[model samples]
Target: MISFLRKIRQKLLSQNRVTQYLAYAIGEIFLVVIGILIALQINTWNQQRIENNEELEILLGLKDEFENNLEELNFSITINTKVTEACVQLTQLIRSNSIANDSDLLDDLLVRIGTFNSFDAQTGVSSEIVNSGKLTLLKNDALRTRIINWLTLLIDQEEDILFRSDNYTMNMMPFLMKHFPLANGELTKKLPFDKKKYLQNYQEKSPFKFNIAKEEYLEFENQIWHHKHNNDYVSINELNLKDFLKITLQMIEEELNKKK
Candidate 1:
């Protein structure tokens, strides 16, 4: 093509026809410019296609990760709800001075009060997308904003979980240890050994014999109230996180459908 165009230009120059040669030169320049623009447009299209594919893959991965996170978060909420209920019941029993009437119920509530579940989210895909600067590949403005906000939500949720965990470890456990027999919590029922035999052994070998009758209920009730408050906070956060995950997942699904 280059050789053909050069030969034509040479012939036009040799003819000594200035007007025709200038017109031909202008036409050739226009064609060359058009060719260059077409080439650039094709290159841009190819680049965009590659980026769209990459974005699709990331969205699929995020869908799976967030789904898993949502399931785990629901379970944590359920467990925390039970713990909060236990706290409420224990408080009521203590206030009514009827806790000693039901030793079994007291033991069960004690175990429940000390139990907790943390929302351990799966953030591998989202973290990589944000940290590696691939979040921009996501073309949807709403989706991008939601993802950025999701990270912040996790931070808030973690703080609530940490507070609940610390309460269980530092406040509830110590108070229970001082005022109640750990073995009476029915934990031995889950052990490999026979429950009766384990309880007997625990009773015989235990250094501290806690008599609930002699223990003050007011201090224990205060601890229960504090732990319950922490549980309530965590539960609220988990609910909000669950809603965020659901919305994000819906957006991801919409994006995936667009790709298809």
Candidate 2:
């Protein structure tokens, strides 16, 4: 094509057709510019295609991660709900004064007292996107904002988990160990703390009975307060985390629907 155009220009020059040669020269320059523009446009299209594919992959990965997170979060919520209910039952039983000698009730309360539930959201895909500077690839403004907000939500939940766990560790466990026998028994497995010694120490009673003394009852009340505190703290955060997961999952579905 270049050779043919050059031959035309040479012929025009040889004939001394200055007006025709200049017109042809301008036309040739216009064609070259058009070709360059077309090449640039094609390159841009190809780059965009690659980016779209990457965004889809990230979205799919996030979908799987969040789906699993949602399941775990729901389960945690259920467990925490049970903990809250058990706390309420124990509190009522202690406050009533009518059920003080109910050893069977004590057994149930002991099992309930040992329960704890927590959740940790998965951030593998989100962390990669944020760290690698690929958040812009999300394309959907709503989706990107929610994905960024997930980190903040996760941090809040983790802080609450730590706070509640500290309550159980520093306040509740020490109180229980000091006042109660904590003998080795089947109940050991149910409690969140170290069960090895409890398992080895008392193998006779499945649910060891503790005679509720005045001081022990007082300590039980104190321990129940801490348990309730932790339960409330965890329950509220768990609900919030669940809500965030649900909303983010909805946004992901919307984006995926758009792609389909």
Candidate 3:
């Protein structure tokens, strides 16, 4: 192609057609420029297609992670509700002078005391995307903003859970162990209890005998207060998780549809 154009230019020059040769040269340059632009456009299209596929994979991974997170949040919410209810019942009994000789109630209350959910969401893929500067590939401005907000809230939730866990493990449990006997403390640290045997024998074999004292009841009241405080935080985080998960899932669906 270059040789043919050069020959044409030489022939035009030999004929001394200066005006015609200049016009022909300009047209040839324009065609070359157009070809380069077309090649560049094709390259840009291919690169965009690769990026789109990668974004879809990231979005699908996020969907799976958040779905699992939703399940965990639901479970935590249920446990928090149960713990809150148990704390309320115990507090009411103490306030009403109805706690005397309520060994059965005490046993039940103890069982519900430290059953906290300490779950962490799977954010490996999301974190990698954000930290590696791939977040811009999301394309949708709204979705990007939502994802950032969700990650921020997740950090907040994790901090709250840590605070609650510290309260339960360091303050609450130590107080309980000091005052009352727990038969299954060792068993609980490892795995699920052998339910039938545990329920039947826990009270009898407990190191500290059943004793209802004013000081013990007061300590339990303090424990209940801490539990209630943590319960409220759990409820707040559960709602946050639900809302974030719902919005992200919708955005993911939209992106998937666009991909198809």
lDDT of each: 0.84, 0.79, 0.78
Which runs in model 1 stand beyond 4 Å of their true positions?
Answer: 187-209, 213-215
lDDT of 3 by residue, 1-260 (tens): 89999999999999999999999999999999999999999999999999998899889888888888888777777777777887888788777776556755665677676666665777888788889888999988898888788789888888888888888888887777776565544333321233355433332445555555776777778887887788679777887788878888888888889888
Model 2 scores a C-alpha lDDT of 0.79
Q: With candidate 2 superimposed using the best TM-score fit, by how many Å does residue 39's alpha carbon deviate from the native? A: 0.7
lDDT of 1 by residue, 1-260 (tens): 99998998889889888888899999999999999999999999999999999999999999999999998889888888888898899899898887768766787788777667788898899999999999999999999999989988989888888888887888788878877777766543332223365443233323545565535676778889999998899999899889889989999999999988
* Better model by TM-score: candidate 1 vs candidate 2: 1
Ranking by lDDT: 1, 2, 3
Superposed model 3: Cα runs more than 4 Å off: 184-204
The true-versus-predicted C-alpha distance at residue 16 of model 2, in Å, is 1.2
- Ten residues in a row with the worst lDDT in model 1? 186-195
What order do candidates take by TM-score, descending? 1, 2, 3
lDDT of 2 by residue, 85-105 (tens): 878887888887755466456
